[model samples]
Target: MKVTEKTKISELIKHSPETIEVIASVNSHFNKLRNPILRKLLASRVTLKEAAKIGKCELSVLIEKLKPLGFEFEIDMYEDSSNEKINEVIPNQIFDSLDVRPILNQGQDPFQMIMSKVNILPLGKTLEIISPFQPIPLIRILEQKNHTCICNEKEGIFSLFITKNSNEGLENNVLEKKIINKIDSFDEFQNKISTFEKENKLERLDVRGLEMPLPMVTILEKLEYMPKEFALFVHHFQIPQFLLPELEKRNFFMDYFIVEEKEIHLLIYN
Candidate 1:
């Protein structure tokens, strides 16, 4: 198959399993793809073109590297999107904006950060998503949930203007309304813990739809500064298999419960 800018990383891997080594060898950071968690969360969503940008490698160089893997990219696809300005684009008018490039820079998935904000966005309010590269997969997901969006590319940064699709009846598909309402600060979150410990307050970290390592990292980091009596609550979309062992190693046990078939809650404590 002819490689194009829109060719997803997972498709490339599926088409030719050898492409993984070629992509990883292209840059040190791309080596994260070797991890199953990263591959599962990112590979299906990131395009080859976006992969090159994320890897901080020249498009031409990445294209050349792919040649050995039986994939050939067109010359036009080699033109990096960063150097070109996206013209005639009118972004959605948004008062609130989120810049998740910081999270990406820290080697964490910014997917949930964007979704979390979007979940609570009210009528007539717009959410601007700022990222290092075009977040195509997320845009597609929002589109599925019936959100209208406009995309813009300036220099290397991509901005997406998002608003709930009125035609779709303003449905919040990714996160439940109860969970969105449940979102609170560290202090407020502590007030709503399980009955297992009354004296030991618990903080809630709602990670619904958060990608792999980000959820695990956020939980562990919070645990570091937490009081010995404190517990941590997690609202997740799925079980974090990778985090279970880490919690066990720290002598913390987790209790899981599902609510309304839409949200899963986990309580972690020593």
Candidate 2:
């Protein structure tokens, strides 16, 4: 069967029960594919196309993933060329910038301020918005207008780059880090994360600013050395919808909290 955006998850699973693991390996949320609640609640209603939009995944990537899982579908190479790449970045790429952290800390909404500034830009200009965290909701709004966004979080700061003339595709895929090293000396829980960050344990594999397959591959590789039972904290622009199932298959448990919608703290453990 040819897989299109409208291909429902239930139909895919019905094609082959074995596909559950196959598709789940591509994302974490799909791990819940076996859950009665999710299956009954969404599997039937959610199509692959809708899932891509919900998970912020690329349609082409989803189609490619299905191929290895006994899903023989026609490949539409040019079908994705028009899409913008939202993950990979060119260091020091020039752009117009706006910082909204201060406005946010003052209990003011920066939306209007940001729009006021962005609206004045020349056509095809790049607008860089720095914030406290990755604004997934905001990006969703911009995408509807044909804008491309590259999201990055560093040292508690989130940087979002929006461009009108986009040349690449979006990379929302992520990984499971293999080297989950902890601080040699345990300090208070609050200080523990800080120490690990300083020790580079947390920085060892920052999947942020990386593209697909690279993200997923990096994560699976890291999971190899990550300690079982000890919590591992990861920062991502958005939830790794595809990677969730792979983590579940590995017997790992995870829950995430968003840091002002700029950065997501994915806490993973056994």
Candidate 3:
């Protein structure tokens, strides 16, 4: 049968008792059915929209539950060149008008203080933010809590913030090494972040002052290797909503604890 909009694969299976044979035949050539969940969904004989909803819902729940632990979760939305659709859906201008001073002025808050001095710029049509480590005291506090912390720099001046959870004992030497190691060449740093995520050893990796192509490329790579049992703590400056769809296309996944200055959002992807 010709696959058309009105025809539901799930319905086809339900109507055909030999559906399993057909599915097996197709799966033999393409391994998509190797995934039990996907196989089950296909076997259910549901509409393609229903199957997609199942996948989206599963991912959403996973991301939500991972929020408290600090994960960077997102949905990927797509659009065309008119810029009208993208702007209407995921407005890039929000960062240009974002306020940070108030968040920074919040008394004795570490996340707030760190975000205050950061600057987010537009890279192409995408938004980017850099939050560097400005307050030494706050760094010490996070380190004392046994978490991994990162500070970014542009022209030797601090500019971005990213962190990961850690259990290592904090000595200045250890903390310094962790931060320093995260600064391998921009490419290396990005690769290392993915490796850390894959290995579940990622303790807060922050990228700053890197040029175009680097951020977008790394973001794509990061999504590909997103860990199932890790949380990402990020201080949002200006990031894109389309990142999620980009990741979805590649089957990328991640959960996030995104602190935009002070307001916190938790994201989980199952």
Candidate 4:
């Protein structure tokens, strides 16, 4: 099969099972692909372009590795100008800055803190995130919300600048409300689930025991082929911060019941 930087790792593996080993050899980070579950979860969400970033390797390296396996390259990887653009700076008015290193040091998730700032972000104003490494998943999630992001790395530190586009209609308060609705009350959550169940249009999925990103991946894959009239009932471990913006992008509304600190039930519907 023809391959490009945009080609998904899953597609490459499906084209040639040997790709699993070949990709794993690229970097220690990719060795997780040796696990069937990790491969299924990660490969689907990542492309060769993202793999290169996540693995901290060059795209040409991946292309070269797969070339021996008869995979056709879509572009001249050696001369690709895309890498030059990775460091291009887009000037944005910085309104707020968040350093997540301390949060990570405390063994805490900074997603909530990041999203809180993102939700109230003013148009044409940028939110700067300081991190030890590129937060690719967080970048992807915010980009799905129509936010523009430019990331630059220096000395193993990544500075990501994100701004909401004025043309995306983010200035509309109604649209903002529609984009971030969280039903947290147990009574309200139960009522919504009961209503969906009674209509016989509730589809069930359990992503409780899955690892990070797997739960998000599983939920997104299920939603892709979900019937429009039906709602998805998801048994999850926590409110998936990364998944929330994606659902909002797809115009899906969500409600959740916090059964415990680690057990949560979500009702997602259009």
RMSD of each: 10.3, 14.7, 19.6, 6.1
Error of 2 at 79 (Å): 24
What is candidate 2's lDDT per residue for 1-270, written digit by digit as tens?
A: 666666788898888776667666767746656554345335665667655544556777677777777676654544532224433333334357888877655444566556555566555667789886555445644564567666655555767787765323222222234422223332333465565567555523466666433454566666667765355676665566545545755777655555656455565666
lDDT for each residue of candidate 1 in 17-104, tens digit (9 for 90 to 100): 8888988997796997886655755788777777876777777778888897778675574355543433222344465788887765
Give residue 172's lDDT in candidate 2 (0 to 100).
29
Give model 1's TM-score versus the native structure. Answer: 0.53
Best by lDDT: 4
Determine which window of 10 residues in candidate 2 has minimal summed lDDT. 167-176
Please give each candidate's TM-score.
Answer: 0.53, 0.32, 0.22, 0.57
Point out where model 3 deviates above 4 Å: 1-203, 226-228, 231-236, 251-270
Best by TM-score: 4
Better of 1 and 2 by TM-score: 1
Q: Each model's C-alpha lDDT? A: 0.66, 0.58, 0.36, 0.76
Ten-residue region with minimum lDDT total, candidate 4: 168-177
lDDT for model 1, on a 0 to 1 scale? 0.66
Q: Which is superior by TM-score, 1 or 4? A: 4
